[model samples]
Every structure is written in C-alpha cells, then in structure tokens.
Target: MAMIDLTRGLRSHPVRPPASGIARRRSFWERIHLDPWLLGMLLLLMLAGLVVLYSASGQHLQVPIAQGVRFGVALTVMLVLAQFTPATFQRWAFPAYLAGVLMLVAVELIGDMGMGAQRWLVIPGVIRFQPSELMKLAMPMMVASYLCRRELPPRVRDLAVCGLLIGLPVVLIAKQPDLGTSLLVATAGVFVVLLAGLTWRFIAILALLATAALPLLWMNLHNYQRQRVLTFLDPNSDPLGSGWNIIQSTTAIGSGGLLGKGWLQGTQSQLEFLPERHTDFIVAVLGEEFGLVGMLAFLMLYLVIVMRGIVMAGGAQNTFGRLLAGSIILTFFIYVFVNVGMVSGILPVVGVPLPLVSFGGTSSVTLMAGFGILMAIHTHRRLLPR
Candidate 1:
C-alpha cells in the first residue's frame, strides 16, 4: 500500500521549467501592478503640492499657470521613479553615491554660483540641478548598505567608519554654505546607525565629541552662518535685519489665534509682511490661514506617514530592507522638524524646506524619489514576510 501511494504521488504531476527572457520580464510587470498603494501616495502628495505651490507662488505667478506645469513635470518623474524596485536600486546604489560625490566634487571645482553659494550645475540648454539633493537619498543608502552587513549593535570602530563616510559629503555641503541639506544628510545616516541597535554609551560618546568639535566648527562658519546662530539666540537683537524673518514669522503664527486669518487672506502673507511665504515659511502661511486646527492635521499626516515607515522597516525581511526604510522615514521627520523649527524661534535658520508643502522642482522630485524607495522596501518586505 505504501509503494502504491508513493507511485501515485510521483505520477500526479510534473514540475514546469523556469521562466526565461520575455516570460520572466512579464511576471515582474504583473507583480508591480498588483500593488499600487505606493503610487497612490505619490499622486496624493503631488496634487497637494500643486495646490500649495499655486497658493504659495501667488506673489510671483500672476496667472499661476507655470505652477501647474511644474507639478505636471514632477508627477511624471515621480511615476517613472515608482516603477523601480528596491533590488534595482540596490544594484545602482554604490554607483549613484559615487556619481553624487563626484558631482559635489565637480561643483566645488567648476559649478555655477547662486545665492552666494556654489551648488548648482548647469548643462548648456538642459537645466540646473543640485548635487546635494541627490545626497539626501544617496548618503543614507550608501551608509546603511555598508553597515547592514555588520552584526547587530555595531562596534565603536564600525561607527567611526560610518561617521567618516557621512562626514565627507556633509563637510562638502557645509562648505557650499548649504547647512540645511548637510544637516539633513547627517540626520539620515545617524538614524540608520541608531536603528541598527547603537548603544547609549556610543550615543553619549557622540554627544561629547560633537560638543568638543563646536569651537573648531565655529571657526569654519561663514559670516552669515555666524549671524544665524546669533539671531537664533536673540532674534530681538536684530529685529530688522538678520532676525526679521523669524520675528515676522512669529507674529504671523501668533496672530492666527485659534481659527486663523483665513486662506489666501493671511494679512501677513497678503500684506507681504512675512518673508519666504511659499518656501521655508509655508508653515506660517498654514498657521495664519488655517490656524492650530490645520497645523494639528498636518502634524497628524506626518505622524501617520512616519509611523507607517517604521512599521515597514520593523517588518522588513533583511538588514538592507530595514535600514533603507528606517533611514528614509527618519530623514523625513528631520525635514518636518527643521522646517517647523526654523519658522518658529527654536532652531537657527538653515534653509530647510517644508517637505511637500514648500515650492521647488528639485526638492519635490527628490522627495518623491525617497517616497518611492519606501514603497519598494515596504512591498518587498511583505513578500518575504519577515
């Protein structure tokens, strides 16, 4: 009876051959279509950004038609980026980081000057773009990938190497005088390290070392940089010059009260009392127009998005998946915090843009790229179910 049962099982079916060429490629496409929530967020953010951009760009755009065009371009780029998988990104991670660093190196050498900083690269009739923006994503991926191979709870030596990798681009970016982005990249790298189970001892040591470096870093600051630090301590000291932005932003925020001045009718924004209304200070616009209720809702959206990323990272099947998702999410938190801090009087003005709310083609596209990677990690994590 056992022999007859074994024969029947063996004869039941024959295994098929592996997929090859076009058939294999078709299977990949089918899987991506099965999951479109990733694409959904990109669409949502793009639409929201478009509305905010038009409202923010009102001063500059008489008709605001160009704002729509920019969003259209950004949306197309985001959709194209969404199609890529984490594995596809893994293959190109090192090369992309290398290229990004080289571009920064080139920017130091022959880049165009802008806003008193040498950070833009212009190619003939094409366009100008910031290399540092690429670092926003590349630095995290490169550092996380390097440390992912190590055993959990990395050693001091391992952390030192990681710091060096992080510091190189950060130093270059700071040299460009773009302190905001430099800080963001560092935050992203450090978040990945912390998530990898860094001990409190290492965290304490890092705090001490950072404190020790303050004087040396202080000497390296540009004059404007020095002014920002001073203004942060006492915006009242220079209420009309270096501190004008913060003071005005504060008034706009305070005047909002409970319900705010109403949308597009913000006296500060309409009367042009607020500086950078559409960009770094958009929070002020939201606060002035929509009040605390709007601010709370916005905060909740950020919280939900960040928590979702944490969930995805925790559930990731492997080290790379976990690190990638965690780093992106934390960097996003930095963007929100820094932007809000700058508008408020808490943090120094470092020129960090409010994530989806601020206006800029490069930033919007870069943010979408990071979000796409989060999708990749989340989707892949579910497949492995770790």
Candidate 2:
C-alpha cells in the first residue's frame, strides 16, 4: 500500500527539468524585488536626463553629478520599499495618512518659508523637506485602502468620506500656497476614488461644481497666482516682466526645429536668455538641443512607462493594489502633462517639474518610492483562492 501511494504521488506531480540560465537570472531579479523591464526603462530615461542636464547647465559637470547622487538615493529607497508586501502598505495606510496630515498642520504653524511660500519644514541641522510631497504618496495609499474593503461603485456615504479625506490635505497645502502640489495631491486621491468604480454622473456633476467654483477660487488667489493665469492667457501682454519665462521657453523650443541646433548649441539656453534651464524649464533645453525628433522619442519612452504601469495595475491580485497602482501612475501622467503644458505656454506656470527629468531631490524620491510600491504589488502576487 505504501509503495502504491508513492507511485500515485509521483504520477500526480511529474518531475520537471532544471531552470535554464536565463530563467535563473530572471528569478534572481524577482528575488531581490525588482522588475527588470520597468527598471531598465527608468535607467534609460534618467541617463537621457543627465545628458540633457549637462547641456542645460552650461556644460557643468557638477550639475549632472549632483543629480546622479540623488538618483542613487532614490533608487535605493525604491528597492527597499519594494521588499515589502502590499498587505503591509495597506495596514500602514491610515497611520501614514494621519501622520502626514499632522505634519501638514505643523507646516502651517511653523514651517520655514522659501521663495515666497511656506512649503518646507526644517529640523535645524537635521532635515528639510515638503510635507506636501509626503501627502502625494500617502493620499492615494489611504484612499485605496479605504475603498478596497467597501462595495464597488461606492455608495454616496463612502464617496463623501473619501472626498473629505482628500479635501483636508488639499485645503492645507493650498493655504501653504503651493497650488501645484495641492492639485497633484488632490488628483492622486481622486484617481483612487475614480478607479473604485465612480459613476459617470458623479464625475459630470463634480465637473460642473468645479466649473461653478472657479470664479470663487479665482477671487481667493494670491496676487502672483492671479498673474500666472493672466500671463497664460496672453504672455505677450508682459513679455519682459511676468511673461519672460513662457516667452523664452517657447523661443527655445520653437528654435529647435527639425534636427535642433545641436547639443550645447541652443542660443536661448547657452546665451542665458532662457530662465530656469536646469529645473522646471529643462524640457525646453531638450527641445532646443535635440530638436523635435528627440522630444518625440523621449515622449515615446514616457508612454511606454505609463503603459507598463497600467498593465501592472490591471494584473494586481487585489483591489487595493489595483487602485493604488492606477492612481500613482495616473498622477504621474498629470505631472508630465502639467509641466509640459506650462513650458509650452498653454498652461500657467505653477512650478511643476517634469517627472524624473527635472532637477530636484524631494520629488525624485517621492516618485521613485511610488514606483517601488508598484514593484511590490507586482512581485508579491500569489496564487490564492478567489
């Protein structure tokens, strides 16, 4: 009987061949909690950014070096975060959200002011960063976690609660007068709610309400904020004053015709006519140096990244994973759109930096961490009963 049972077990589970070298290599990456395709694309994009940064910074080596170091730190944070499971993120969502909100409140009370905005919190000789950046991740996490346990196509009560959750931080950040980050945080939370099966009617009604509230919102804008809107409408109205940035940006991009003027050869950038060349307006540098062809190539790469993220979101094993991943990627798309639109003079300059391509520390780290969460959701999936 024992021999017969052993034979039956062997028949039920046949022996398999050993994994090939390629399979082993693939498994090694998965074991370390990394996604090869996503990582590969990100590295390629960052390399291109460094090349553009070198030219944009007047051929300065230090600029690219500093950005490279920040990239390293961001990548390390991503890998560390990727080691955790989706369940861990879900469990910590509420507490993280609460802590982030508290920090935003603290920023309101005693945050350091910089360049005309109270957006940073500094612990003397320790750390200085934006609480709004933290909410960029925390908002989606909290919303996704909240919605996963409830019924799909959420009820009015759930939607109201979610709206309240989203609105609190938005109001705080807007008070800090960082309109770009406030809108970004709001978009992050809203994406999660929308992904949880929001109805088309609710979306339309919300749009109507937002349209109606625009005038009231306009009334409360700061003087500079109002100037940005007016400038967007007609940059030529004040070409040498508040309109200088958009004018120069458009000049740089338009000058970079079919093949561009060549790397490090952009008159607008190299001659110092362009403003913020290394940060918010860096895309214009790429456009000037590499031409329309280069811009399209860069955008194609970005599109691939976005599509890959969407595929990961769809494949996620749980609702929380799907919602969080979808929101993060969609918010990232909004970042790219807003920055490019602002640079091209179609939208107001709200100080949004191009994702992964812009020169900045906090935003880079936040974005990489979000991708890390995505990798976690993808790699940690298991074959569980439905």
lDDT of each: 0.78, 0.93
Against the true structure, candidate 2 reaches a TM-score of 0.96
Model 1 weakest 10-residue run by lDDT: 33-42
Q: Model 1: per-residue lDDT, tens digit, 1-386?
A: 33334454555566454678776765564466222444455456556655555555655554245545665676666556556666667777788889989999999999899879999999989999999999988988887788877878888788888888889999988888798989888888888888889788878987999999999989999999999999999999989899999999989888888888777768887788888888899888888878888788777777777777677667767787788788988888889988998898899999998887787778877876787677666665433211
For model 2 the local lDDT of residue 327 reads 97
Off by over 4 Å in 1: 1-30, 33-46, 59-67, 382-386
Rate residue 219 of model 1 by lDDT: 93
lDDT of 2 at 174: 96
Clash pairs for candidate 1: none
- Worst 10-residue lDDT window, candidate 2: 1-10
Measured with C-alpha atoms, the lDDT of residue 300 in candidate 2 is 93
Rate residue 153 of model 1 by lDDT: 86
Q: How many residue pairs clash in each candidate?
A: 0, 0
